[model samples]
Target: MTRYWVRAFLSGLALSAATAMLTVTASADKLFGAMEKAYVTNPTLNAARAGQRATDELVPQALSGWRPTISVFGEVSRTRSSKEGVPIITPDGPDVDSVAINNATSGNVSIQLSQPLFRGFGTVNQTKSAEARVDAGKQNLLATEQQVLFDVVQAYMDVYAGRQYVVLRRQDVSALEAQVKAARDRFAVGEITRTDVAQAQARLAESQSFLVNAQTDLARAVASYVQMVGQEPGKLSYPKVVSIPNSLKMALDVAGEINPQLLAQAFVEVARNSDISVAFSNLLPSADLVASAAGSDPDFAQSKDRSSAVQVGAQLTIPLYEAGAVYSQVRQAKQLASQSRIQVIEVARAVRQAVASSWNAYVGLAQIIKNTRTQVSAAQLALNGVQQEYQAGTRTTLDVLDAQRDLVQAQVLQVTAERNRVVSGYQLLAAIGHLTAVEVGLKVPIYDPDANYKRVRNKWIGTDVKTVE
Candidate 1:
């Protein structure tokens, strides 16, 4: 009998090891690989890049003011005329019963070129404004990249924690099932009362319900993971904690320098200031160099009645008055500039706030993780002790059930705390502007937002647009 029992124990142990191996194989996906995939495939990040490319066109549009415009025009026409006169006695021979008709066809073509000499410095100011806006757009793109990556991190962690919770709940359900059976066996042997058996059965039902809820939550988390990463989640490995500044003040200082949102707002303020100059420029004089060449035939009946000419001159226009429209535009621009300045301040404050909050949360989660780990260990010990005491008749079935429940809760708390710690660490990195793909060393090509700008900014003629791969 002893040899038979030993063989059975070894067989069960081998089966458990095989199951663990299978679980490990199924979850071999690593966090960084998932992030790299999302960085390449996320729609939100790609859309932001497209939007930035569109913004780059503004530079060339503004530069057009400094270039000459050429145009050609042509015209063709036919003319017919008839005259009738009363009969006259002498004079010319044809005057006796004079009637005359004439027909003529003529064509002409002309070309003109105009180059802006000066536009009250509007071109310069507008170009400056457009360039600033493009810079701001690049920063916005960076912010979008960070946001998408952070979202991926968040979803990955959620699914990771959700999977753990489901496993714990399943284990809890299995433990209670065994406890319920043992309780029934004891009651049948008159070693325990019906009440104890009922309590054990009730706990088992509750654990089963918890297991179902945990499973549902895991499904939702997987759906979210798919949405963020643009694919189904594999078994996710735990993400490594990202580095952050050592002190809150240091974090704030770092954020002030590199935070994408804050820098974008600052660029907006610069653009707004340039806009004020552009609007004020409208009230100043503008000059253009205009040149044209033309040829015309006045009448087909007289082939010699042709003329050609070339003209060159400078044209100047001073805005004396525009019914107060230009003045109102100038005022509007000034107000907008003022608003942008305030927005910069607002964004700076918000960035600092985010940095502080993320730092605090990260620190707090670390403590929670430590405490929950301790609680899990203690609860496990207490459950083992209660189970042994119940077998010895020194503890009740209720005690054992309560101890089991405590252990499960502590284990769940530990998972949650650890998950939150990872997430908060990422959040802190994002707040300090360090959560970008390149900063994280993702093994993918870094997207240079300026590449599109450089390609399009100086292009004088092209209907074709180059898209980034």
Candidate 2:
């Protein structure tokens, strides 16, 4: 007997394992690859990345003005001046051919160099402005990433919801099919009327319509996910999840301080304020080393010692006056600075409002979840009692069916409540500016925006780093 029992147990285990393996295989081709698609082919997010890289060039461009510039210039030419010159003639030796056309093609080449000796503060201000813009670009990249994360989360949840609804509707259809069978069997025994079976058929048809709607929703959600992530959403098994916030005020506070969009706006204000300094710098003198070398043939027809001239010195430019264009620029810079400040204030206010709203939603949805749980429990108990009464012949068919429908609807509401609660949690975290790819368990190559800044801010000199100064 022990040997027989051992063999039966082994057989049962093998059968169970096979069934599980089949189920796993059947469900394999879906959501397991969503993150891969997101990291690889998300166009909107990639475009933002490219923008960030482009903005990083400003740092190098600003640093170039601080470095030396050198040029090796030469020219070959033949020219005749209309001005009166020494009397000349062809062979007659009079002044008839007065126009002098000296073959002035002389090799005059000198490598001249100009370096900025000093600027009031223009270089400093411009560098600061560029740095600020780089900071802003980093923030913009962060904001773009956050937006993409939200889109992925929202799309993922939508797909999960559609799938769940499909299952729920399928269950309802199955239950209706069972009811139709029971009704038909009862009618053959004369215990039920033809109307009852017809009613059951109609209910099945209604459930079929619901199935169609659920499938339609699933298709749309899948399309959106595929567009965002660059892969198709197949079958997925999403865990029943909860989003719980530890503290609303804490979340709100964190988001207001770190939110990328808010930071980006603040950086813009800083950049524009730096522009004010740049404008002020224009009012100060600019000192630059100026050098020029030229060898001119006064009379190439005669000798080379008469006309070659070379000059090398520093040029200092002092801003004296400009029909008010410089002053107008100063005013404009100040106005822009003021506008930027106002924008920061406005964006801060808007951030706070968003925080408050998300906080409220999180709290409200938590309450709804609690209430829905109670409703689901009560509905389930009521459904059990109605089924018991129906089997005992104390409840009418209509009464039993009504209870079942109510229970199903209650369960559906419970699903929606859970979904909303978790989504609200995501929204709360997102509002506080703490939404990261890691927080959502996404595996992506982390983007390092500061790396670019560090690389160019210190090393960029002149227009080209390798150019001879």
Task: Provide the overall lDDT of each model, using Cα atoms, as 2-decimal numbers.
Answer: 0.89, 0.74
* lDDT comparing candidate 1 with the true structure: 0.89
- What is the number of backbone collisions in each predicted candidate, taken in the order shown? 0, 1
The local lDDT score (0 to 100) that residue 374 gets in candidate 1 is 93
Error of 2 at 59 (Å): 1.4
Clash-forming residue pairs, model 1: none
What digit string (tens of lDDT, one per residue) describes model 2 on residues 43-122?
88778777786688888778887898889876556654464565776676678537655344444556678899888888
TM-score of each: 0.87, 0.76
Instruction: Please estimate how well model 2 matches the true structure, expressed as its whole-model Cα lDDT.
Output: 0.74
Give the residue spans of candidate 2 off by over 4 A. 1-41, 78-111, 177-203, 239-245, 296-308, 384-401, 438-444, 458-469
Best by TM-score: 1
Query: Measured by TM-score, how close is model 2 to the native structure?
Result: 0.76
Clashing residue pairs found in predicted model 2: 255-432
Q: lDDT per residue, candidate 1, 302-324, as tens digits? A: 87989999999999998889899
The all-Cα superposition gives candidate 1 an RMSD in Å to the true structure of: 10.9
